[model samples]
Target: MQRAGNAFVDLIDDVFDNYRQFQHSNDFQQYTSWAKQFKSKLSHALNTWIPKASAFVLNLLSKLRTSMTAWWFFLDHPEVPPDNNLAERSLRLAVTKRKVSGGSRYN
Candidate 1:
């Protein structure tokens, strides 16, 4: 099941990777169809397994389900990156500056 989930994610990434070439063409409809199918599979997986999952896994799934729309931006706007790596990297500069200065000091 985990492998299946991973494959689904990879498939979504592969679909989005072609967005630049397809954004303005009918090819994008293929991605839209894939996105809807992925959502259905995800929902089915959750319904089938979540009840038997551990508490931690349940919580994690809750978070994923809640944030799924944001992650599925490719469905509505395929131009957006799939991950927040750039936003995360932007925070490194602030962290480095703080460390260079004096580090955090809070009560």
Candidate 2:
């Protein structure tokens, strides 16, 4: 299970690396090609690993499978990012303030 998780992370990392490279070069065609390959690899991995996965991993995979289209939405739009890091970062300060203040009485 650990090996499978590690391999899945590695695959995602590889795809992100390739996406960055293609983005830098402004190579839409290359990105499209890589996206197709990624879809194939991801599908194969899910098929192969999900069957052997534990309950926790199976739950994770179930969410992933259902949200698969959202996951690859960035591939269809050059302006979209592959991750939500920027949005999350933007919310960090607000979240921190809310946590520090505890619950708001008005809300």
Candidate 3:
């Protein structure tokens, strides 16, 4: 059971590595190719029967499969960000600033 879980995690890590590579690489053709290959590989991995697949992993994979449309948005819009890290960070910073300002009791 542990072995099956580890293998599933490794496959997921591979997918994430491929995604990060695609995100970092500015080549449109390469990203498209990687995305197609990643989708195929992930689909195959998800289809494989694991002896003791956890519900969490199964649900995660289901969510990923359903979010395919948003995954490849970068292909159509080169300006689109590959991840939401920047936006998330900006929001965090805004919240921090607001909290600090509110606590400071500035006019």
Model 3 agreement with the true structure over 5-71: per-residue lDDT tens digits: 6766786676557566766886778766776776676667656733235787667656656785675
Predicted candidate 3: what Cα RMSD to the true structure? Answer: 4.6
Candidate topping TM-score = 2
- TM-scores vs. true structure, each candidate: 0.58, 0.80, 0.56
- lDDT of every predicted structure (CA atoms): 0.69, 0.85, 0.65
Sequence-dependent TM-score of model 1? 0.58
- Cα error of candidate 2 at position 40, Å: 0.2
Q: What's the C-alpha lDDT at position 101 in model 2?
A: 90
For each candidate, how many residue pairs have backbone atoms clashing (under 3 Å)?
Answer: 0, 0, 0
- Give per-residue CA lDDT, model 1, range 2-95, as digits (tens): 7545755675566556564565675767767766786787677666656766778777767767887876665676667566779999899999
Query: How do these models rank on lDDT, best leading?
Result: 2, 1, 3
Between candidates 1 and 2, name the one with more favorable TM-score.
Answer: 2
Whole-structure CA lDDT of model 1: 0.69
